[model samples]
Target: MKIMKTVQKVPGGMMVVPLLIGAIINTVAPHALKIGSFTTAVFSSAGVASFVGLQTFFVGTNLKFKEAPEALRRGSVLLVAKYLAGLILAIITNKIFGLSGFLGISVLAIICSVTGSNGSLYLSLMGTYGDSKDTAAQGILNIHDGPFLALITLGASGLASIPLLSLLAAIVPLLVGCILGNADKDLRDFFSPGASIVIPFVGFTIGAGINFSLIIKAGLSGILVGLLVFFVGGGLSILADRYINKRPGYAGAAIASAAGNTIASPAAIAIIDPKYKPFVASATTQIAAAVVLTVIIVPPLVAWMAKRYGCPKFDEQKAKNASLQES
Candidate 1:
């Protein structure tokens, strides 16, 4: 009962707390632990492992492989929209600004890929717009952005060189969790507590990337890029929510896109571009900024959009009706 009560109170508590702890450690003691690159890699690996374990424990309980096709289909559609949006924007910025080389292009791509944990938060906040299936799908889809960002930033040449084995090492556990969740409800319940633990780690790791120097270097150009990606990506997502989802009051979904998942981007970049360690600081700062912006801005915008568009309240009545019809 205590565990249940805590879980109820803090939905993503597990993920959020450790992340703050990490940030505090970074801020207070970055130099305290001078582990070599190998140790750093070990820490990173450990973090990923924790995340995968948490995901597996929760998702396994919720697994329903029979539903995999539908989930995959939805995930694929979202992936395409996400990648296409980022790629086009990056290309335009590169062409117009006369920016050359992978560095500039990669930075722009990273910005686009930084959509945060809004989908999970939206699932918690909106309460009615999404069902279990929608929530599950969002969880799975959220994991993809990191890998996709890595691929895009690396480009064709680096893409081939990227350590696929390492990438899969990070991704497979989460996938396994989701698959398990589809299969067993009890397992999902067991792992659910870990979600709160792992979720904030995502935030913290992303936050650790933030340093003052990189922000100064990025200056006005980086700020502009971040804003453009946030707004345009947001707008396109809104359109998709309306036309594709065909569900009323879908502004929450739009906000999810705008919320840019910054935490994963830095790690992705680190893995892809060893020479660009400093850029990780820039990515981190940008992600922190994006997180603040998304949390503050996206929710209100979604509410306003819903009201303006005459979106009906997603209440129990609607749910009951849908459930009955489906049954």
Candidate 2:
């Protein structure tokens, strides 16, 4: 049946299909796999962070010491571009609608939802359409995964004491793996397969955390947030990659999706600032919808952009072959 080949033909299918399967399980039974032990661990929401951490470590192993500098530049540009997109739109939303935004969308939702990029999904996409250096840059994109960056940008930087450890906690695993891999080629090869191995699980765990019902609940406003995520994140980020980073912009487009962890950011921000408390529920739902939508939207966007710009996917010698034949 060529099952693996068939799956690979779908845009971001490796990650996306598992995510949808998990979402279906959650939506239907929602408790069938929560019986503890490895079953629950592998098939439920319990493994989200663990799977992501494991995936990050694997991605690090593929990166060479020589490529780290350019990876940093690419990753940093993506991080800034994603953040700025969220901040600009969020500030404009705030000016227009204030904290209690109209149609159930808030500044908090815009900031938290759009600013963060999905690291697991990015790694999977890069595996399909990018090279080792491009995937290694996931280490830097790891920083904005949770509430840390949004908190700082939300005026909490000066007044409130935010936890720097959360940010450190995300990056440290990737850094350690990179260090160990750079120190030993054998170790790098050993862990190299580990990243791709964990991808489907990462998607499943994250999807278990999501409820498709939220997309229905979010409605028009939710759809708007999702489109905002794709357009703003994709648009600005692609431009930043081309002009600022001086590279093909497929990477920026790839990273335009919301982080799976972002659904929690509204509540996290609300806890720190009571002003956001009233909007948390609505924002969370909207962000949840945005997360799902972007995962669907951005992958194909990246695939198309990669083909358009000639990215070097490890799996795609054909892309290179086509380039040579044309020349």
Candidate 3:
């Protein structure tokens, strides 16, 4: 009961429970189900689940396309900040630190792409910061990490390795959700509940991919890489939020966004470099672990920073609810 309660309290924890179960199954009985490539199956299922979840959430919630402009502006700012941070860092790492392999590039790209949990969670927590316009921006921006990583990998390698089609496959559902969200107010409300269901399955697939053996092999180097990206990438987000936006919560928001790149990077890497499967797999696992850690840690850090900076907290929920009510 206590564990269940704790999971309920945690953002996206219920969704993660299914993922944990899947991982346990893999750990205990690796050969139980030869499900025609676990990664492909899991990813495919996740895509469908996400689509259903988003449709359900948005179907009932009122969405205003008029506010699309505001959402786009904010979303663009955040996306640019995220993209440049990753691209610049990856280049620097490659040029200066001799970290030029696919693993190194993918790791750096992943780091930059990391973004926080969708603004909905923050809105829910902060209660007042709920703006549907902002949430819409957040939703659109949240999904950009995968495409941006793919673009970066393509640019760096001078090879079109990451499958354009695969990236599209991942992106189409989210895009559809956004469109459906704008089309019908009810769609957002309907889709929101399903997010709770879909997220955990995604988490389970991620956990199932984790291999202790690979982590041991990568050892300190991988750990160092992960930490460096988390810290440095996180710092860049802060700077962008502060200097670029002159907003307090923006820093934390940026950090949150940067943290989610784990999901994006591995998928991109798998498509790009099939030969280095283990390296990509290990890097993906490490990135996912980093994302979970950052999600747990960065919000409080951002809250503290916001308090210190005396920046007004944006109540995303209030704004969202207001928008819905107005609509």
Candidate 4:
């Protein structure tokens, strides 16, 4: 069995499946893994925190500083649009619900979920339906690797008084890795796979921290947030790509999906502000669900938008492939 191929066939399966499996095991037998030996070393919350930090470092190494200016411009436009969408949502939600949150959803979670783009999904879609410039934008878009943006937005809103040093602490690993990677091509290649390889471990660790019951309560709210990410992110990106970037806007739709790493942001935020701890479990679950929801929904929407906007090669190939399968 082509296990890797099979797994890759499912949208976000690499991260999502491990997460679900971990969540189920942890839910059913919370104490089974706590045998006080090697099991504790690998799956404990401390272990997860280590992996999350390591993952951030790996992601930083993958950023290419010497990319074409056009790629940076395109990516910046999308990033700004995505950030603004989530910032607007956070501000509105804060005004209405304040720090207490509403209907099991917190402003912190809302900001994190909407602001971060699913780079994996975006790359997949862009590879198929977009141009080189579109795909290259991942370099700049990846800066949203951690919870820094969410924290920054919250601080800006006066909802939280996060220390500047804490904000720098969150970004320092990525910055160090970026400097090392930029200085050495070999180092970049070596650390690049670490980003992908560490995801399942991180996902499993995050899943184990969550309770399935919280997932059930947050599922619908997460789905609603995912839909909002799709439309608002998609709409703004399309406009930016067309007007600002002067390119076909397929990338806009492609990048509108919520990122898998977003599942970690809620917990990361909780670390920054203990006040957010109450919402962390539900927010984590909700963000995980949103990642899945957007992964499934955004690709088709991108294809449709591509067709409507007059990109036929992608759809033509897709139709050809589908017909070939029928034969």
The candidate that wins on lDDT is: 2
For model 1, residues 8-114, the per-residue Cα lDDT tens digits are 34323333334345545555667532365744533332344344344434543454666656655554455455555666665665666533324443453344443
Model 4 stretches with alpha carbons more than 4 Å out: 1-67, 156-217, 312-327
Off by over 4 Å in 1: 1-25, 28-49, 100-171, 178-217, 247-327
lDDT of each: 0.48, 0.82, 0.48, 0.70
Tell me model 4's lDDT, rounded to 2 decimals.
0.70
Q: Report how far off residue 208 is in candidate 4 (Å).
A: 16
Each prediction's TM-score versus the true structure: 0.55, 0.89, 0.57, 0.60
Across residues 1-327, which tens digit of lDDT does each residue of candidate 3 receive? 598688755433554454456556665765543456754455432333443334324422433556667656655666666556666666665666543345444443344344323332232222222244434455445444344454454354454344566545543554676677667667666665554344455455544544334444555545544455456656665676667655554333434522443455555555665643545655665555554444344445545564466433334445778999999
Candidate 2 lDDT score at position 25 = 91
Tell me the tens digit of each residue's lDDT in model 2 across 242-310. 899877778888888888788888898888899889889888888888887887778788877887776
Clashes of each: 32, 0, 51, 0
Candidate 4: tens digits of C-alpha lDDT, residues 89-130? 788889998965677777777888888887655654554456
| Model 2: how far residue 327 lies from native, Å | 18
Model 2, which residues run further than 4 Å from truth? 314-316, 319-327
Better of 3 and 4 by lDDT: 4
